[model samples]
Target chain A: MAAESHPGYGMRSHRSTLLRRLLRYVLLVATALVVAFPIYITVVNALLTPQQIAARPPTLFPLHPHWGAFASAFSTGHLGIFLRNSLIVTVTITLAELVTSALAGYAFAFVRFPFRRTVFFLCIATLMIPMEVTLVPNRETIVALGWFNSFPALIVPFLASGFGTFLFRQAFLGMPGDLRDAAALDGYGHWRFMTRVVLPMNRPVIGAFAVFAFLSAWNQYLWPLVVTETNGVRTVQIGLRQLQALSIDQTNIIFAGTVLAALPIFVILVVFQKQLVRGLTAGALKG
Target chain B: MSDTRRRRRLGEAALGYVFVLPALAVFGVFVFYPLVKTFVLGFYRTPPFPNLPSHFVGLSQYGSVLTSPAFLDSLWRTVLFVLFTVPLGIALGVALALLAHQRLAGIRIFRTIFSSTVATSVAVASVIFYTLLNPEVGLLSYWLGGRGGAGILQSPTLALPAVSVVTIWQNLGFVFILMSAALQSIPDDLMDAARVDGSSMWYRFWHVTLPLLSPTVFFAVVVGTIGSFQAFGQIDLLTQGGPNNHTDVLIYSLYQQAFVFNNTGVAAVMSVLLFAILLLLTAVQFRFFERRVFYGR
Candidate 1:
């Protein structure tokens, strides 16, 4: 019916369809393997011992797994402290952004206020201004505040995001008006309604923003490098750079450090796969 | 009653500002204020530290930075990097998206594998490539050892291309996801209609699907170009502006001047230039390409 339905076309035989599907499957798997092979080898190298790594014509797979690679990476590579620093900065920023964006989003969406359009336009304008343009001045600001080398220095600048606010605002705008009226009838003011209904109901947006915020904060290189003068407050990204500079000879150990640095984000990505896709494609569908 | 209603309205307006204050305060201090300071900083030559006095220099800094051979070279390299990455990145993204869009069993697994690079941070991705491209003990170097028996990244000529390879690989996932989303969004009925009109598969794809995909392609190009322009982590890790400064793109050059060389004024000028380029690129994209972008009715 599918082929015959189209005029001037004959229906495709089932066998051809099956064959086409089989070819697609092969192509897809082959491409996936090719894309994934670098990561596979990286993991394999991370699991190999120093001697095995140095062996000529490098071993493709680790015959005997070296679990000690991770232990060394954490203890010696200083990745443990780096990981802790990354978690602290990421969590602090994510929580603060979630609250601020959600609050601002609710204000923009539900509350009729003076100068709302102007304020919203200003907030959205920040999205077009790349963060790299602000690096020099922000570093100066951090120094003036004496927050340099402190957690606040790493966390405060990114506590609120224009993108997060926009994402949440779009989410809030999609809510039915009747629901807001009904909530108002139930004596739920803006604050109460936001906390009780909007926040809970927009879990997907919250989750998406949370994953995005955390990932951005975690992956931040330039800001953390600029602000943090000491290794004590440095994040995993900066620490990875330090490791690369310091331990070029210890290639296997560096791979171990890489694994440790990337593992949590990988786990988060796997767990929050849908939210990541939604967060990423959210911009694509819009502007 | 009217007075009470007016009071309520005023109360709501006050609450709205109150709600927006936290985000506003952060943006005001960090984003907006910094933007203004960047412009001001461009006009003054400041010492490395904050306490030192800064002298006004007008647009001289911009003129010097624009004419500097180092800046000019890096700008040329950056344009090359954009050329190397954007079109190829778009083409590969579209190809992968088209390939994965087919209906088949276990297709979701393939999608996951293709998109997995999104999980990799720039730092992690660079580290992976650093290990993979190490001449002394890298898999790729051992496999594809060319003249001089050095890694591709170690060679002066091949460094940019090697770094470009890492970027292209890292960016493929993002581009693929965006393209696949655009593809999936195209209604099946339109394609069906084309088929009913006796359009061959190639004809349908070229005329119908390709037109529908221009907006996504355009978006990818704009974002990809901006991203490549600002890309620092890969350049920092992979080449450190290189064996010969061949990989010394704009952002890294700015960073070196600002932080390493303590030339904040030069860096500020470069920042302004970068911003202008991005603005111009975005404008050009919309002005030239917007007409071709098919907005489905």
Candidate 2:
């Protein structure tokens, strides 16, 4: 009697568990769809005509797709130039940030110096003093240097990042001390050890910071807007704005510009999703 | 110590300084010096006229500007934006994290979808929403029951909230990623123990999951508050702080004063005041929330 009851109970619970799992998936799929709705609409509308877009109750999908918006965005919208500029600025800034951050972070983590703690604290303190606070004076400095509407103004102020320094420092400090000792015993100097051993071991952190720096540098709007007066050096973000203003009636063209501006980052996100997540959450989780 | 040993130690210290110099130089020019100059600029009033010299006004402008109705209104609008974005972003993030945290098949795809907005820059996000909020052609406007004629972004009463929605949506992926990470760090045994004790899922979530997640929540709130305080791109792209200055938060106000109106001294003062308010808010959050955060052993 006990054995027979046990089998019946197991089957009932199994059916209920299956039902619960199905319900969970249903809810998850629904939420994911809602969250991703905007991107889907943007992509679909980028392929639609202005007439279709303006249709009452708006076209939900591109039944008949048009690719002219993209071609026009590149040809007339100057999106190609903007994209090249964005790529140049972002890559340069990311590389510079990595070099500066790795060096400073290594010094703080592994080297001993006078007022080391105080200096490290000061570096971290700069994180609190955001760009918004320093905007006016920085702009003056840019103008004073005759770097207005130039790459130097966009690139120079951001070459050093306190956040990057802190991230690298934390990652370096977490490394095993024996690696350093081993490298030293093998007649490795600071530069050699860092190049061959330390940096290679911390690729994950480096990759993480690289993605962050690239994203931020690419996405910059205010500083670029303030500094760059011409389209010669303007980034894609600003270009998208210009496109919108110039073609107020052309919704499809604006969407195409947006798609172009956002595509690179989305690709980056897809490729380096792990590093982005790990790096972003590193601060929060550890704190 | 031997002389060689002393020399080596000194050499190491010098190298340390060398490694740090480039970073410090950049910071000095861009960050530290500008900070001091901003404070100094606060004391001198630049006239709206381009050719006119800036007059030294001491603390008079600070007094007047701080008490001005324009400044007060902008501050209030900023606070309203913070209230609108941070908590709701956090709640939605938690909800998404909870849904995605389940041990279901193909969960990774769902996680990616949920966190994809993190890739969208403020500009991209604004542009996406710009098209979505268009009065005549916008599907969202139609579905959302936006009143006939003007879109949500154009409506004086609805503009700020509309902007806030974009801000929240843009930040959703970040909060989702953070919360999902926090949820993953939680031990499976804790949930199993509660289940064995016949505690319902809600009870376990309330008693166990929430306490463990408080630290991340606190971090998100502080960071979200700071981000909201400095919001600019969306306003510039969408409203330009118009339709009666309803969406003119403090940062936008500072931008107008410094760049548009050429009230450099007033803008400088606004920057200083913003920094103080942010510092105070951070300190207050730490004092109030830090003790309540549970660090599970």
Candidate 3:
């Protein structure tokens, strides 16, 4: 009698536990839906024509989806030029940042030099200095060099990234001394060893920082807006804002342009979400 | 003593310095040079290019800025923004971090959703939000107000706070990610130990978590405060410094006085004042670090 009753109770308890998990799954799925709603709305609205968007209750489908916005964005304006300008600025900054950061990180991590720790600390200290405090002076220096309104004006000032130096330094510091010793035993020398061995191992991290550096440089508005005024060097962001200012009357086009401006960033985020998350938490936690 | 070995040692040392000097040179030209230029430019005024000769105005520009009502008003507004953003950001950060730290189902998905906005540029965010909050065509108002109601951005009283909401949302992901990592560094053993002692979760968090998390909290506060002061792009894009210059901070004002109004000296003066404020605040923060930071010791 005891065995039969116990077996029946155990099965009943397991069934309720299964039911609880099912309920939790439903709730989790619901939460995810709400969280994803904004991106859904943004993309849907971007694809839809103005008339379709204006319709009540906002049906999920557009009456007539327009691929023509992209064409208009390109042909009717300097969006092409803006894209070229963005590419040039982003590429140059990334190259400079990578080269400088690797060397500096290598030095701080591996090399024996006078006041090496102090120099590294100072480099890290630069991270704490507010960007605003430096903006005026940075601008003055750029103008004084006659680089204002030029591409160099946008690029040169930010070549020394405190955050990058810090990242590289810490990553390099974690390297085993025996690797360098082994390299030295082979007479590879310091620079060659760093170039061959250290840099290759650092590719994962460098790729991560590359995305960050590119995004940060590309998204720059305050400094770029201040420096570049002419159509010759205008970036996509600056151009979009200028276009929006023109579209106060035509609200649809303004939203359309905003959607266009936000597209590349949104796409990058979606694809590289994992890498960016890893990079951010890694930098924050490690540093 | 082998001369070749000694030479090789020297060469290696030389190589290290050689590799590093170019980066140092760039830093010197770009950052250090401008740092010095700030002091010089503080005392002079010049017209924009195709012209030369900054008239040395000495202390007059500085004097005028120090006494200006507008400068004082901006300083107050900046303080208000800092006061609003820092604590609120820290609170939101802590809440979101702790919420994700729970053993709830699908927590990773929740984290990714909250953090998605961090990848969006401030420029993109500002643009997206401006459209969303516009007086006429904005969806928020269309939903909230049946028809013909004032949009948040179009209202002078509402614009700054509305813009602040966008900033807060944008910055939330960054702060959450940072603080969550900080929280993770605190081993679960500590919480379990407190639970064994009959402490509630709130009690454990208040006693254990916060003290341990103070360093990151302090860091976030400083970064948030500094960013608040320097904020220009959102205000410039959305409000154009205001429905009536209601949202102008120091950087926006500096941008206007220098470039828009062509009062380069006055702008330089305002910039210097901004620098001084930041330097003083940083100094104070550094001084507090030794006393306040728990470091789990």
Candidate 4:
């Protein structure tokens, strides 16, 4: 409305608009390059020969690419074992979290139980307690259970999550009430209706949550670092750190291990980024 | 209430308990139990051997941990780390979000690129940064006149900041994604109204957009501060809390006290302290920042 009185105020000439667009493109491109610089340099160094990486100026691009670095790093660093360990841990956690969260979420959403509200609140309250605070006691518990330096130690502590329960509860609550009522008319009980109908309907939320849980498990460093001492059960993240420490002089080999460590997660992320975005935004909204 | 109605109600309650039992079991053993155990363990000096019994030391462990110079320095450094990362991460995220909010060709590509670092784990990022700042073979160090090839991570004064840089970079994608979502939710009609009223760009942002964005920004700050406090991998891979313990944060200090030095009782006290700090900060945010948030719909 105010533009009628001062037409030129908020309006720009076509020429100036074009100039602004150009400047914006330049800025965007520059920022993108800077943001991507670390990945770029790491990849380039991973593919370069040791002598090339050790050059005084440090080769910006690999003039003669050496792909063998990956194979050797995989063999010498036991990266294959690490990757398998990570996959087993991440998949187990994802499946376990999904099942537990879905069950608890269904209870909160549909079932009429005594102390339901209290139980839900207590579960949610666990989010406030950082895992670091429980590290010592958890280690002692694992040792006592005779599960130290094993998959149980690595996976058991994180088998369930409060946040996942909250997310799934919200998802179940969002489902249409009539759907459940109709299923009830067909002699379907809680478990039958949940598995047959409700779970299928909330695939997107479950998928998104699964991706998130997987990412967190895959990227987990501290817990695995503390729990697993032997290379037999070590994760790729810890393996990379150990590789770096051992291969200090072999920069190219270390870079290769780093690339290997990051590659699977990077690919998974790009493929599931939409789910990730939705999951993250959903979290922000609830918070 | 008829007999059938009572029977149905009892069955429903039983089903609810059955459904929630597994999760409750995990939370009991791993979360709540450990929390209570840590508090109890703070009073006992446990030897390094698994078979050795922990003797009750009353409050001696807590006293020592609180009075120790190392713990005090780590506490200060943790505060500084939070201060360093949270504001800068939010600001950088906001800037990138605003920059990429334009309606233009290939804008999605730029958005994706800005958020790419979210995929890199802390270890991956730290390793990349270590090589980049390696002084002897690093490209950035070469550019910075490497002082006979010595990297930034080597200096005691720059160690914390160096680790902070890695932390900021690692968090940039997460913050950008969050802020961009918040910014996109701002209505176009409101912006048009502000512009038609002859308000400048900065004026519209400060008075209109920012007020609406306060909630998301506050969320980012809270999450970022908690994360920065718990940061371990970067410090471990980059500086190892070193160059004279300059980069030692609360979580890293707890790690050292527990595993490295086998001082379990002291570590328990520190964990309790860390837990208290997180609770206090979260409470403060909810009390103060929640008031400023604009829930316009």
Which candidate ranks first by lDDT, i.e. highest?
2
Candidate 2 interface RMSD after superposing interface residues:
7.8
lDDT of 2 by residue, A219-266 (tens): 999899889988889999999889877554578888888889999999
For every prediction, compared with the true complex, DockQ reads 0.51, 0.48, 0.30, 0.50
Candidate lDDT (C-alpha), each: 0.85, 0.89, 0.72, 0.87
Q: Candidates sorted by lDDT, descending order?
A: 2, 4, 1, 3
lDDT of 2 by residue, B1-297 (tens): 999999999999999999999899999999999999999999998876889889999999889989999999999999999999999999999999888876677988999999999888999999898878877677888788757534788889999999999999999999999998888777776666777777777997889889989999999999999999999999998899977999999999999988888888999999999989988988999999999988767
**Model 2 misses residue A171 by how many Å?**
1.4
Instruction: List model 4 lDDT by residue over A146-223, tens digit each.
Output: 998999998888888899999999899988779888999999999899999989999989988988898889999999
List runs of model 2 lying over 4 Å from the truth: A1-12, B146-150
Deviation from truth (RMSD, Å), model 4: 3.5
| Predicted structure with the largest DockQ when compared to the true one | 1
Tens digits of lDDT, candidate 1, A187-237: 998889999999999998799889888888889988888888787999999
In candidate 2, position A202 carries an lDDT of: 93
DockQ of candidate 4 compared with the true complex: 0.50
Reference-based TM-score, model 1 = 0.94
Q: Compared with the true structure, what per-residue lDDT tens digits does model 3 show for residues B1-297? A: 699988766776776677567677776665566556666777886656637777887888788789889999888877877777778878978877765665555677777776666765677668777765655555556665755444677676777787787777778877887777787777666666776787776887789888878877877877788888778888887777776777887888888887688776777677678878887887887688748877664
lDDT of 1 by residue, B1-297 (tens): 699999999999999999899999999999999888898899998666778998898988788888989999999999999998889988988988888776566767887888878878889889888887777777777767644545678778889988888999988888888888778777777777898888788898799988888877888888898899888999999999987898999999989988998888888888889889888888998898888787655
What pairs collide in candidate 1?
Answer: none
Mark the 10 consecutive residues where model 4 chain B has the least summed lDDT.
Answer: B142-151
What TM-score does chain A of model 3 get? 0.85
Model 3 chain A weakest 10-residue run by lDDT? A1-10
